[model samples]
Target chain A: MAINLKIENKAVVEKIAKLEEHLHLQALKGFFAEVADMTMFTLRFFKEALKPRYEFKELIKQAYLIGYKSFPLIAITGLIMGLVLTIQSRPTLAEFGAESWLPAMVAVSIVREIGPVITALIFAGKVGSGIGAELASMKVTEQIDAMEVSGINPFKYLVVTRIAAATFMLPVLVIASDAISMYGAYIGVNLKGDVTFHLFFLEVFDKLSFSDVFPALIKTVFFGFAVGLIGCFKGYNADKGTEGVGKSANAAVVYGSLMVFVIDMIAVQVTSLFS
Target chain B: MKKTTGNKVKLGIFVSASVILLITGIYFIGQRQQLFNNTFTISGIFKDINGLEVGNNVRFAGINVGVVEDIQQVTDSTVKVDMVIRDETRKFMKKNAKAIIGSDGLMGNQIVTIIPGPAGKAQVVDNDIIATAKTVSMDEILTKIKVTADNAAIITTDLAAVIDNIHAGKGTIGKLLMDSSMAGTVNDAMVNIKQAAGGLNQNMTAASHNFLLRGYFKKKEKKAQDKADEEKKASEKDKK
Candidate 1:
């Protein structure tokens, strides 16, 4: 009976020890593995990007589909973003009797931070899922293998073009969206007060410096790259089933958004170092 | 194939429009900073900039005509600020133009205001070191405000005490304002004054008509009549 008790006690201790190890070490282990995988994937992207087979024509097509197609939605979103932000910010600035500063304040808020972030998030939701599901469906149907057997460079045509399109197109979209949003802000400012278009733009230009603009612009490029890369990574590695398609689409948006915020944080820190 | 070309053209227009929009924005912002404009550089040495930064607007005659391009510490007590003013505004800036750091509003960013010098002075040239006036910093203004506020507080407190004294009927003014006894005293004094004036008038009238003074009064009347007669003759002669 004593021997049985000893064995039971020893087993209980071992179980607790195993539980502790899982709790303490497993999370760190998983995180490091994820980081390693991400780094390797990024390296693969760089390698694939420099590959010999060009996909210029496909890139233009994808650009049309991704950028041109996304404009109306992004434009509407941008307008709403500027209008809502201005309308919402009025009371706070009014409290300080700084209602005249509306143009500068709204312009800085939109151009520096909100325009790129909200647009990138929207882009991730729309384009990320679209790429993920399309690629995932192709993978599940073994169409990728069929293309490979048929002697076409599928990655160059498929992955590279889409990624490049997203990478280049986002900045264009952001620029357009920012301009439209400023126009929307002008309307917002005029809703309760009178400000001519000329004065409003002058006020905006007065406050915004190159430092305010260029860093924000450069970060959007990185945001575009991150969103596209994460989407491609998730979709291209999807399992060969219909369920994998759904998972890929969902993970694509989730990871893309997560990485956008992650990249924004890092970008802000680095930008602070310069200015 | 035709549809593809059409789509490509549409895409091209969109891309070009977007790039144009970006360039236009950059141009305007750059123009505000005197980056694209033909500009003339000028430097001012200030003891304190009062938080004036690079890219802060430099106003001339209440118009933003330049921007602060650089700020560097020249000495322990002096900071040199380089400015780039639009070439168009250069003609208005006199060689003796004074740069004073001022704020946009009561609570806005610091700006350097260029006060035009004497009208006869020559126009300022490029790279000229302009004169700088010692500006009152926000902290200094706040300190002055605090002192004024303190004085106000003391005055208000003293006023309150004076008001309380009036309410309690303490000082002469307090008594005048608040004391019913003082009011009655003033009323009695006024009545006494009125009686004294009446008595004095009576005495003067009695004295004027006294028997001893009757002769003197008659003599005075005769002299006055003679003078009136003489004045009348002179007036008649002048009229003639």
Candidate 2:
């Protein structure tokens, strides 16, 4: 009896190990499969984007929904970011007797990095999830299929328009956010100290250059494209009905936000190479 | 339809405002760089730039007048810097004006400061090479500070030794201040000196009263009296 029990225990352990190996292999396969699908999706996007019958009306609508609607949140966050950064940075700079450098330092920080990145994250949370859930629900309800059956190109009408609007509108939003953040920084500087508006702006412009502005603006275009593409890809391919919609939205936000940082890292590396 | 139109109008306005803001920002930065202005180029040769890069401000009379446009290594030891200054500033900048690389603050970017030349010199023309003075770099200042700090450390060490010696009553000042026995001896000497001085005074009185010294004392008294009388006569004449 003792010998039989030992053999059974060994067999069970072997089975468990095999199961674990199988699960890891499945995960690896799924990751590569997803990467392949995403590549195809991106290629399709470029192809459709460059093709003739452009969806101007839909693009305009998406821009309004994505860019204009996202402004209030972006603006509020921008103001807080600027104010908090200045307030927090003041103590350290003051220790070095460099409080006068507040405006120029804050301006470079916001224009070069914080303004585009934070705005893009907020945009991903709002628009990425919204696009993901909307298309996911449409997919589950067979609306995409119905449109296709009725001789309409749903992918061109839905996906390309959104991606294009996102690519173009993000830079504009970032510019507005940067301006508002500068005002916030000015207010912050005057909270504990006094600097005239003229001098404040002069210091800000003194430190800024074409290199700081142009590369930051260009990267937002990529950040927007990533967010929109990820959201659309997740939603358009969703399955399993109502459950799929929730999963798609959650994954969209997660992946979109992730892609923003990844793209940012690449952009910084590329910019540094040129600089 | 109405809602769509309204949304479009709002979007248009927002886009326009954002674009305007961007343009305004660009304009300000450009203006600081002497871009979109009537400008002229000038160059200065310096022994070392001390990390002054292109696009650093060129300040004239404490106001930003231009930007550093280019920097080239002219020799192993000298660098030539090109500046784009506004044309309007030409009258103020003279041929003998000197450019010095300075910092914006204790911790700020390097700037080229143009010190105006003496009046009556010719105005600087475009592409003119101006003289440059070697401004002190932070490393040099820090090196000087380190030397001072080292001297201070040595002085402090010596001072501490001197204080220790005084505490141990090793030197004259130390003995004067810290030795109780010496202090008692000094007190006794002071008393003896006082007694000696009193005896000298009495002896001098006695000596003045002696016959031979009496004549001398009497003569001194008479001379002092005559001097006083002459002074009184002089005052009377002046008053009259």
Candidate 3:
């Protein structure tokens, strides 16, 4: 009886170890698979983005939805960001008797770093979640498959237009955001110190150069592309259920925001290298 | 469908506004760099640029009219700075214009200050090498200040010594300023002079009253009264 019990116990331990190994292998496999899938998706996006048969109407529609719809939110966030940044930065600058440096300082801060990063995060949260959930629902209801069966080229029509719209519109939005943020900064400046609109703008522009503007503007395009691509990828491959839609939406925001910071880091490095 | 159409119109407006803003911003920045307008390149060779870099503003008469486009070291003692100034400003920039490296503010970037020369001189043309003045560097000014301060310190020390000497009644000035006995002697001399002057006045009055000088004294008094009456009449006329 002892020998029989020992054999069973040893077999159970082996089985448990085997199961753990299998789970680890599966996780590792899933990670690489996802990476490979994303790479393929990105490659396909490039292919479709340049194809001859352009989806002009769809592009316009997506632009309307993505760019116009999101402007108010972006503008509000930008205003608050500039206002808060100026108010918070006042005491430190006032200590140095450099209160006049407020407009230029805030302009540099917003144009170079804060504006792009914050706007991209907001874009990720709203647009990324929207894209992810929409695609995921279409996936769960078999709409994507139906489109594929009907020879609709669903990826080109849906993913391409959204991605292109994001890529095109984000820079425009960032420019608008920067302008609005400057206005907010002006208000913030006048809250404590009086600055004419012309003088404030002059101060802002005096500090800004091509280096500050171009690199940041270029990065926003990449940021938008990354957010849209990840959102679309996650949603398109989402598991067929209500839970999958929720998961896709969550992952879209998470990964999109994460990539924005990551891209920002890389952009800063590149900019520093050139500068 | 109607909602989509309205959204499209809104998007168009937003996009158009954004594009306009972006273009305006770029134009302003480009204008600052002398990029959009027709510009002429002029070079200036300086002993030192004083940290002035390419893309730094070049100010003419305290107004930014151009930018430092290129900075190159030609020799150990000479640095060549190329400036791109607006063509519109060319008419005003004479051939004798000078360039000097200056700071934007107390703690701001180094900028090139273009000093306009005599108005009668020929205008500066494209690729013209303008004159450059050696700027008095901050270190040089600090050195001068240090020398002045050192001299001031020495002078103050000498002044303190002289003051001490005056307090001790060592020199002539010291005796005059600090010697109590000398002050008393001077006071007695002043008193004697005052008494002598009073006695001299009494003697002169007595002498003038003599018959031989009485006419002269009376004539002088009459002349003085006439002058006073003329002045009073002139003053009354002026006041009226």
Could you report the DockQ of all the candidates, in the order they appear?
A: 0.63, 0.71, 0.49
Runs of candidate 1 exceeding 4 Å displacement: A1-31, B145-240
> Who is ahead in DockQ, 2 or 3?
2
TM-score of chain B of each: 0.65, 0.79, 0.64
Q: What ordering of candidates by TM-score runs from best to worst?
A: 2, 1, 3
CAPRI-style class, candidate 2: medium
Worst 10 residues of 1 chain A by lDDT: A37-46
lDDT (Cα, 0-100) at B187 in candidate 1: 100
User: Which one is best on lDDT?
Assistant: 2
In terms of DockQ, the best-performing candidate is 2
Top-down DockQ ranking: 2, 1, 3
Per-residue lDDT tens digits for candidate 1, residues B1-240, read 898898899889999999999888889888888878899999999998888898888999999888899999999999999999999998788999999998889889889999999889999898999999997676888999999999999999999998999899898888999889889999999999999999999997787799988888789889999999999999999999
**Tens digit per residue, CA lDDT, model 3, A1-275:** 99999999999999999999999999999999999999999999999889878999999999988888899999999999999999999999999888999999999999999999999999999999999999999999999999999999999999999999988888989999999999999999999998999999988887788888899999999999999999999999999789999999999999999999999999999999999
Residue lDDT tens for model 2, A1-275? 99999999999999999999999999999999999999999999999989989999999999999999999999999999889889999999999999999999999999999999999999999999999999999999999999999998999999999888888888999999999999999999999999999999999998899899999999999999999999999999998679999999999999999999999999999999999
Give the runs in model 2 whose Cα sits over 4 Å from its true position.
A1-4, A94-97, A190-196, B1-6, B152-240
Q: What C-alpha RMSD separates each model from the true structure?
A: 5.4, 3.5, 8.7
